[model samples]
Target: MMNPAPALPRLAIHYCTGCRWLMRAAWMAQELLTTFEKELGEVALVPGHGGVFRILCDDELLWDRKIDGGFPDIKALKQRVRDRIAPGKALGHSETAAH
Candidate 1:
């Protein structure tokens, strides 16, 4: 018998309408989905307020705009998500130098 693979993580991106974070949030979602298509279960866009921009994976908070003092770099965000959901996976150039 072989061991089963872990369940794919669910990512939720919450962006504030008041701050016009839709494009940023959507772009991040697109990048994550494209990069981790097979590893991620889903990426949900959630509307929010008060300059809120957060990324949650499997109900765990991964990034926060206000808390982190600004938006996250897409590559960094990918690493963060990958660390939690697919620790053994490599992000290739995204994790290399010059970033």
Candidate 2:
């Protein structure tokens, strides 16, 4: 018998509370949840500090604001998460728009 596919990954969005990035972090969480509803197990919003903003999947770091030097574009962020969780999935308009 063939083995079943692995379960979906858990996503964590950590944003700097001191920088007041709650809205930005929450918005990205909402976008990811909406786009990958079927493939994601959960999305957690974590409060952080020192202008830190990061996205992690299954404990692996995906994005970091300090390193990237800015907030991620919504569409680009979606594509990055999709690439990890559901590689074959399409992201509709998010994929077509220029970044």
Candidate 3:
């Protein structure tokens, strides 16, 4: 019998087309995929409307632009994903440069 495949995190970025946030969404996805190349299963870009911009790791909400009051900067975003998927993982310059 074949062993079951390992479960991996799937990330989704939902950005509003009406608000022209696709480039931002795509860029974030690129950053995440490059950062978590081994830890993640997939990253999906989901088109949305009404100024919605969100990031989800599986079913867990990572960021919501509206409720959070603004978009998350790259550093904050990288830290958020790292915290959820690989706690204690160092983010290199992304973690240290600001300090």
Candidate 4:
């Protein structure tokens, strides 16, 4: 194992309504969280206010990403999370919370 990398950036994903894709997205978020922890230490992938899973990092603005479309929308979601984390880094790592 290697020492954790510098704090690249923070990311937060928010899902508003309860939908089938919501859970799917949550799983995807989990996968991202595990994969990116090396570059972005102490990241958070949490289920937001309304059963909405969110990924929170240093960038507070990222908390506002509300993805409506499911599954296929993951690409966009990943982009947004990547944008929030840092340009070069990837996504997958998250801090989970039930809401």
RMSD for all candidates, in order, please.
2.6, 2.6, 1.2, 9.3
Task: Give one digit per residue, the lDDT tens place, for model 2 in 1-99.
Answer: 999987779999999999999999998999899999999989999998988899999998889988877889988898889898899999899989566
Q: What is candidate 1's lDDT per residue for 55-99, written digit by digit as tens?
A: 999999999988988999988999999999889999999999893
Clashing pairs in 1: none
Error of 3 at 84 (Å): 0.6
Best by lDDT: 3
lDDT of each: 0.93, 0.91, 0.94, 0.52
Candidate 1 stretches greater than 4 Å from native: 1-7
Q: Candidate 3: which stretches are off by over 4 Å? A: 97-99
Model with the higher lDDT, candidate 2 or 4 = 2
Q: Which stretch of 10 consecutive residues in model 3 shows the poorest summed lDDT?
A: 90-99
For candidate 3, lDDT tens digit of each residue in 1-99? 999998999999999999999999999999999999988999999999999999999979999999898899988999999999999888998988753
Q: Estimate candidate 4's alpha-carbon lDDT, on a 0 to 1 scale.
A: 0.52
Report the number of the highest-TM-score candidate.
3
Cα lDDT tens digits, model 4, 26-75, are 67667556666555554444443554545455645543334533233445
**How high is each candidate's TM-score?**
0.90, 0.89, 0.94, 0.44
lDDT of 2 at 43: 96
What's the TM for model 3?
0.94
Q: Mark the 10 consecutive residues where model 1 has the least summed lDDT.
A: 90-99
| Candidate 2 TM-score, C-alpha based | 0.89
After TM-score superposition, what is the CA distance of residue 87 in candidate 3 from its true location, in Å?
0.6
